[model samples]
Target: MKKRFRILVTGSAGFIGHHLMLALQRAGHHTVGLDALNNYYDPKLKFRRLQEQGFNTEEIKYDTLLSNSTLHGSYFIQLDLADAPALQQLFKAQAFDIVINLAAQAGVRHSIDHPEQYVASNLVGFANILECCRRNRIKHLLFASSSSVYGLNQDIPFSTSHRTDEPISFYAATKKANEVMAHSYAHLYSLPITGLRFFTVYGPWGRPDMAYYIFSKAIVEGKPIRIFNYGDMLRDFTYVDDVVEGVMQLLDVKPATGKAPYKLYNIGNNQPEQLMEAVAILERLLQRKAKLDLHPIQPGDVRATFADVEDLALETGFKPQTSLREGLSKFIDWFKMYHKINEVHALQEG
Candidate 1:
């Protein structure tokens, strides 16, 4: 029988976190969601996702209560991870069984511009979370790591065992730092921890900063989309639903003996798609061609990423099965519906 206890999901307003909360609620697990809900992206999109899950923004502080949904013990809280005292207070108030740390400063390019935000959210904020977990004696801690940690390695399929000493971006470096930090805590405090290295994650209610979403926006607005690296970059674009499924499967199962209760896995489609190829699929789905301005690759960027999911399969029997075409179609359909862009436009001139 699965153990049922109060679960805390930081970054509940995020694309993955929101979906995970819904999945947890459907499975009858009590959950608490905490997110800063900052204007990093469009806050309206986050609010809409929360609304679908039966959370009213005005009421809850550290957590929001579910009113009409099947979730009997689910709540959402607008909180920042940097607030150590607030996090400590929450841990004191609730007896949480698991803590999924998804709240962090995301984006490779943004990290270059604002290093302080990354330090505050990913480093200091994570330190605060670890302290709270140690104090509360939380059972399991699952935190979000990124595939960008793979850096500039020429390895065809990136594996967890690969040397991750090289990180190109501050964002990737921070994620790497998180793994080291987590390992230290797990080793010292005997805390069970799992770090997930996610590839290019995309789907419904996804962040606008992502390539897929940004390209779609540019295509719709008839604006020229910048094809970085002259359309040479490659990414293992995993669908959001598949990511959520893998996370849900791993929720109860923590690290075990000989594994430090601290494990890492590459959560990705395992099929790397070329930059140009993804754009082609998007154009096909939207029935509109993107205005392209091919440019050289920017700094803090890698040429390709492919996840070796052998370890993930061994751990949770988790396999990413979504194809780019199917996933992109779903996202485009939702985007059109959400933005009320009902009619499809003719393909633009090259």
Candidate 2:
């Protein structure tokens, strides 16, 4: 019989967190979701994700806990991690066994202009999480790190052992800081921590800020899509499902007891695809050619990103198996439905 424990997934309204919550519930684990639901993108999509969990968020207020009606033992709260007192109180009341901190101010370029957001959520918020986990005696803590930590790196496949000190963006700096901070906590408090360095995670219900999502919208709207780095970008583009799977498999696989009870692994497709190639796939799927607006690389953006997920595979007997075309196809399926932008091409008799 598989042992099921109560898991707290922050950013539960987020793309990957939402998927992971369902997966955990499927595995018979009690889940609690926490998201600020700020207008980072659109609260409508976030609330829609919550509703998928059977939550009625119309009257739901901040720092309030609401249980899901359909899914038993599932709950959600609109709370920010930076709210230290509230977070600590929740951890106390919930007595969570495992904590997955996926909530963070995401975006590489956005972080350049909005460093305070990153600091509040990624720095202060993360510190609050660590403190709570330590006091609550949580079994294991798994936090989402990003491939952005490998910023300005020429390494083809970014390994956990690779030098990560030279981050090019404020976002990357925050993530790198997270890894270091996690290591310190794990070392001191003996709290087991696993840092997941995720590659370009993409799929259905993905972040609208992502390039693929933007491409889909622009393709459907007959608008020009920005192709940064003059179409020379490369990314592993790991599917969200693959990332959720990796997290599930590693839920019970806690770090070692001795020394720093911490581990870091890259969760990626291991197959880097070109930026133009992804756009081409989107064009093929939407049945509309993308008007490319090639431009120089943006500040706080890398030319390429690839992951060395051997450690993840070695730890758990799995690696990302979703192909880029298949993943993009699935995303577009949801995109059309969500955005309601189905191709209305007419086949008039010629």
Candidate 3:
């Protein structure tokens, strides 16, 4: 029998974290979650996510203990990742066997305008996590990295072995910094660290800032949708469930200690989908046509992203296999139900 470990998942109220939270609890592993609930997009959705995890939003207070009775009394807390003292205290109190750092300042465009937020959250907050992990002697640490680190390399399928030195956006640069930083910590402290470079992850409970959510909303509400690069982009859009599956499998597979207890893998669908094609699928799902506003690609945007998941597959015998349409269909089903957009006009007015 596999040993069950106590796990801490940061960004637990976020899309990917929330999904992983449920999975961990169902698998009979004790899970603790932490989220800042910042208004990066909308705190309303974040609250709803917490509710889904069986936490009452009315009782939400910073640094306060919250747990879900329905999910085997799983613990959760509302706290910023940058709060070092709080994090350290939590680490010491919880005595977690595994820590997954999914909390970070997400969004490439937002990083351009608010670079300071990125620095505080990604850099400073991550340093705090590394310290706590080192001090607490946690067995393993896993962090969410992004494919944007590829930075328009023109490499057909981005591989883990490829150079990630040229990150085009501040967000990507920060993620690259995380990879190197984690490597150093793993080397110096002998910490087992695994980094996942997720592609365009999408599905239900997804971030509103992502293209899929934005386009879906626009199409549903009969508004114009902006298509960048004249909708000529390609993305290895990995579904949220698939990403979670990869993470779960990797949790049991630690890095071999020789040089450094560190490993990085590209967690993606390994299948690139066209931007316009995804839009078309959305239109079919929503039964509405989108008013297209074609524009040049924005700065910090890449033309295409393709992942080489050979290492991931070989290591874990798992690969992201969700088809774009199937994943989008599931997301649309949840989206419509979540937003109560059965009657589009009401959602538009509100």
Q: Which residue ranges in model 1 land beyond 4 Å of their true spot?
A: 61-72, 344-350
Model 1 gets an lDDT of 0.86
TM-score, every prediction: 0.94, 0.95, 0.95
Q: By lDDT, who's the top model here?
A: 3
What's model 2's TM-score?
0.95
Q: lDDT score, residue 237, model 3?
A: 93
Better of 2 and 3 by lDDT: 3
Model 3 ranges with Cα > 4 A deviation: 60-73, 343-345, 348-350
- For model 1, name the residue pairs that clash: 64-75, 64-76
For candidate 2, write residues 11-87 as lDDT tens digits.
99999998998898788898888998888897788888888876787755444343222333878888999889888
Candidate 1 structure quality by residue, lDDT tens digits, 1-350: 67676788999989898888888888888888888988878788888888878898776643323223233388887878998887887777777888999999889999999999999999999999998998899999999999999897777799998899899999999999999999999988989999999899999888878999889989988899998889988889999999998898888787885536689988999899888988999888877889999999898999899999988788789988889999999998888877777565433321
Each candidate: RMSD to true structure? Answer: 3.7, 3.8, 2.5
The true-versus-predicted C-alpha distance at residue 170 of model 1, in Å, is 0.6
